[model samples]
Target: MKALFDTIKIYPKLIITFLIVLTPLFTLSLVMNKYGSASVKSEITNSMLSKVHFYNSTLENEFGRTIAIMREFARYDDLDLLSNRTEIMNYYEQRGAIRNLQKELSVIKNSSTYIQEASVHIPSIDRTISDDNFGTIQQDEFDALNVLTNHFESPFIYWQDRLFISLPYPIKSNRQPPDFVVDIEISIPLLKNALLQFTNHTAGNTMLVHFEDGWRIGGDEPEGFLQAINSVIQADNADNAELHSATVDGQKYLIAFEKSKTLGTTLIMYERESTVLGPLDRYTVWFWMISILTLIVIMIVSYSVYRLIHRPLRTLVRAFRKVEHGNLSVAFDYRGRDEFQYLYTQFNAMVQRLQQMIQEVYEQKFRVQHAELKQLQSQINPHFLYNSLFILYRLAKKSRDENQIRFSKYLSDYFQFITRNSSDTVTLAEEVQHAKNYVEIQKMRFASQIEVAFGELPASYVDLTVPRLIIQPLLENAYKYGLEEKETGAKLTVQFAEDQADLLIRVEDNGELADEELIANLRRKLDVQDAGLETTGILNVHRRLQLQFGAEYGLVIAQGESGGFSVTIRLPRTTSM
Candidate 1:
């Protein structure tokens, strides 16, 4: 069975495939069939009990009217005098009294709908009369059925074509003697008429059968019903059996039964195996068809999905495999415009970039080694400058030349600033001091030709971090390319201020602004691997800032307000300062 089901997993578009999937559904049908039979039986029992209640009510109503007549008759002024009367005929011959009492009795008897008979049996006169004589019961049964009204139920009741229910009550006098006995009878057909009110025939025929033994109410099955009832008792199952069935020859009869615990009795109801399960059979057929269609649909869908998506991705895998095996010339065969296709195009571009970067590395290996040598060469740079300043100091002291001393001190401070080699990044305050020292050093060479003005230092922004030598290079570029060209007092201003959501540091000079073509070419060179130290510094600062604070905070270069172009360094409001 497991192997058969596994075959369904492989090829699901066949009848056996549905047969496996639909087995649970068939089991559910059998379960529902059982439930339906039990449900119908429960309803049948309720129907019969309900009918029995209606019959009891009808009898009460019929007998109630006869009682009313007797009550009215007892209220007469001469009614209590009946037991003490001397003679029977004399009591009737009591002038106009008998005639008047009989007339009142006649009106009371004829006024009721359910009352078939209303009569008084006078023990003193040994006589009995009724509105009508429907039938009579056997003497023994009548004697057992006649009891005082105080009892809840009587021991006997007669079953005939006419009245199926009867009750007797006494009418006593006040002389420690009895006045009469009142008898009432209710017709059976009248009660059965009320039983027909329940329109649900699937429940079964409802009837009230009050035998001499006891009463049996609820659902009437045709036959083989007793055996099912015997099963209920034999099992001693307190909870009702949901459904049971019996086969008489080739025909099957479904049965459902429930017993009322209070009445200490059983109720049996049966419906046909076909009638109760009609809807279930139809639904099962429909579900079988749907299961077949579902199996076919899953197989078709799985195939279609594998072709559209997995096949295209498989092509990409082959291209990567070829690249892995050192086939550098192999390219992706991309056909669609999706993420996978975009990756294909990007992979081709990346391969070209990788080849170019490899070639440049081979060419620049000498220059890279030379820069490392240069970096190591500058380690004891301050010591050499300090010895030179020391020699100049001794010479100036011996000769008493104050101007020489001042110049040597300035030189010492300048070399110390250059050779500190503290870190690659420093605060804005440190950068400003470095810039001032550079300006002082240049003054000795290009004396009074260049003017440098420092912007107001904001205490809040002075602690801002910048790459070391970034500002100094820009200042050098300004003097070399901009302010150096001016004849009189070339001016340079380094400004810092908060600009809306950004912090700006503007370096401007009274010099020349490069043309658009130069600016565009410089931008391209700054983007290249073989770019010089100047472009590399700006690109490194910009890329680091972009990596740290994102693309919005980086270098901005443009033509200045007055003369030479400016580089405005932009910073974000992420750090506290």
Candidate 2:
């Protein structure tokens, strides 16, 4: 995944990161929204269920009171006296008995608001007296009456296209089966009105279902409403006050129902999903709008960040690219206050320093080549000329000298060796021979004053290449500073040995030091290049050793084993020269 992301450009990468970060927030928002809606729905369902239960109890109590009134009228002694009146009155002329029955029902009807009519039946006279102005019974109600319980309340019944609650009580005077039946009718519209009052402020419908006849009261049913009712009934959850969810006609609803045991009706309260979830729908739309706006803002922020960081980064890359191609003069032009600006300033400084260093190196190289060419052009072997002229002049003045011819031959041989300037470097054997010729010339000058020793070197080491004039300068320094003033017993030794990866050539002189600090100071000067003084032969030899080999191979001064000053020349065992 990291490699895949690395291949992507910064803009897309930032966009993808925003998406990765936003996914969880979007998910959380959706989850909380759904949870909030469900919570609200549950609360509203519980509230509606509570109201349904309250209304159910109210209906139960109202019907209970109606039953109680029916029971009271059935047990009244004055009303029961009508059961024996048929034996005293002729069937055609009992108008006074009928009037008394009507007066009694009228008094019962006026007692409560629920009662729609009241009536008493005489089987012997085949007559019924009622408080209703019609004072008659339809054939279907009469036929249904025969099948009802004589001393109990009946289920809700339809009569004349209107629902009614009937309570029938059989009157018995002498242990006979029944002399007459008393029926009390309470209007169902009053019950519907009571249900409607409870739901005036609610968002849904309230209803009562008659279990015996599948009749519904209190509200118009929507499409598939009957199916939803059937599902509730099948679940046998009519006694439960808990709310249920159902979809009716492709529209969702919350349904809560309760059964009335006394009335054989189930009270159902239902709310459509759209109505109950209206606020949630709006909230969802608003949330989406906010999420879109937030995404837009985040995108803007991402673009801004890319410009702030990426453009500067690209500039750095381009500057480095120029430097990589050897354009050391390249520099950044940024002048902002952020960290990148600091980096740009530092980068510019570094480039300037690098350019200066490179130019110094080039100029130093040019100076070195120019000096070497000039030295080559002016080379005339002055040491050989001075020594040869001195020896020739001294011999000419002393013509009778015994060593005159020998010295002349030696000087001729020395000039023959010294005058050749074929290469800047030569074999160790050649350098040793050149030093031997210089020593031969110096011996003529200080023959009896000092003793000079040249140590033996291996033939394999003799062929190694080394800088010319390197050994002769140290020999000259030893003779000039440490041995020239000594009258006798002054010794100069030139010895060669390999020291690990380096080769050492020690030139020793057993001479008293007037100032030991002088040697120490000279050794210190050899350690630094461009010491800013006229280059002595020894100092020139030390610088050449380092320039050819490195800083580690140079010259150092120490006391020799013979209690005299020793100059040690260190050089690598292998050299490019």
Candidate 3:
């Protein structure tokens, strides 16, 4: 079993892996395409049904309230007085009751959002009293209203392009027109507005249908389209609210409806079938296309992998083994025009680079040793040591015990730090403390000639590992070169600052001789490639920082804002070397 496993190559293994990863995805896509459509259809159906039921209930409640008001107003004793012309003709005597009755009609009309007008008709007197008018109605108008009451069993009647709810509903006998009829006209525009709410949300059409009477209130569709929807609804024969599918004028539609038993009407909402299921159908096509595309890609990738990766990898491996055995002359000779061609060219260049880098490494070692020797020689400056010992001797002869003790201590700490060459790097705190010791020694030597302000190192950067002796050189240079000529008011400032990217230790001095020409010379020296080998001053610090951290971070020198010179030593903000 182990031998057989070892015999299998990368090409077959990769093909097997591709099949393993993609088979389940293809199966999952097929499963989702099959079941997902049904789930989406069910959700759409429930949503449309809920909307249809909501609008249907809204219409029923509004019409039901108007009918209730009409029925209640029909029993008022004032309506009976308007039944005969004698009671109505007694103008002065009945005027008070007549005005009261008109007020009541107005109240009823104003009570419902759907009520356009409310009126009482007296057939015997041929008079009508409405919310707005009290006068005789046309005989044709009375006849039209009278005929509606006789024909429809429901109080909700559609007559002569108008919708109304008449009192004394569910007319069973169709006897003589009731002595007085209370008619509440429903505002078609208001009903359309109510229906528009549903249609606007669903991008559908709405209809309030009186199926038996063949009348509808809210659809601008062709008669055949409306008839087609009605046929589908009747064919469904569902008493409860339902969603149905129908074909009208060769265009498919999805219809949802609920019947209002109180108003004796069906509220139907229908939308284009494509509009409802377009997303699902489009997703199905994309899913199948992607599944097939992925399968083809697997096959094509397997072939490409064998032709591209497997062949180049083998050739590169052979070249690597020859180089691993110390044969530096091995080179790849690939001719194909592809990424492998580039890789082969790079491999050949890399072998040549290896030979050249060997010689450069040896030269670099020699240079580093030479620079270190120069660094050691500059650190033990005979002039600086002579001056320091002479100052101690002078302080002792002056019989200044306090000055001797303090100066000796500062000198001891300064020599101890510089002479101790145990490591190439030290903590920033230790380096700053060493720099302070040198500054203190100089202060005592200058004796009130210089005002030195040493800034406190921030706690965040105190523990950072930096190249040794980087900061102290800047302060030494400031004192020796820049401040030596100043007679009085020789101000020296040392500050520690940091930003988002680097930590800066700035040393500035108010010296008379420091000028732009000196700063430009220092900057030009810093830019020299071999500056690290020549001097043990700012350029040495710059090169050491560049070698340790990066070329971007080092020393920057410029004119100080205090009419003097400033030398800033920049180090990366890091916790370790």
Which parts of model 2 are misplaced by more than 4 Å? 1-28, 86-114, 124-127, 132-140, 150-154, 171-177, 198-203, 222-224, 308-577
Predicted model with the maximum TM-score: 3
lDDT, model 3:
0.80
List ranges where model 1 is wrong by over 4 Å: 1-115, 123-127, 132-151, 154-156, 160-180, 211-285, 296-577
Models ranked on lDDT: 3, 2, 1
Candidates' C-alpha lDDT: 0.56, 0.72, 0.80
Expressed as tens digits, the lDDT of each residue in 1-577 for candidate 2 is: 8898899988778888998999898999889998997898778778888988888887778767766766776676545555656566575545655666677779877866767777766555565678644244444665554435422333556655565555445634555535555666766687567666766446677888765676776777753677666676668654656577887777777777787777777788877867877888899899989999988988898888787786678788898999989999787777678898899999999999988999999798657744653353345446546866887787788757757776777667656554556656778888788788778778888777888889876566777777666787778777767887888899989998887877788999887873568767877787656647545477767776666677787788887877778888887666664
Q: In model 1, what lDDT does residue 79 have?
A: 43
By lDDT, the better pick of 1 and 2 is 2
lDDT, candidate 1, 188-246, per-residue tens: 45444444443245534443433333444334444355444465445657544345566
Candidate 3 lDDT, 375-433, residue by residue in tens: 65347767778999999888888966787899999999988888776677789999899
Worst 10 residues of 1 by lDDT: 148-157
TM-score of candidate 2 relative to the true fold: 0.46
- Provide the RMSD of all predictions against the true structure, rounded to 1 decimal: 17.3, 28.6, 6.2
Give model 1's clash tally: 0
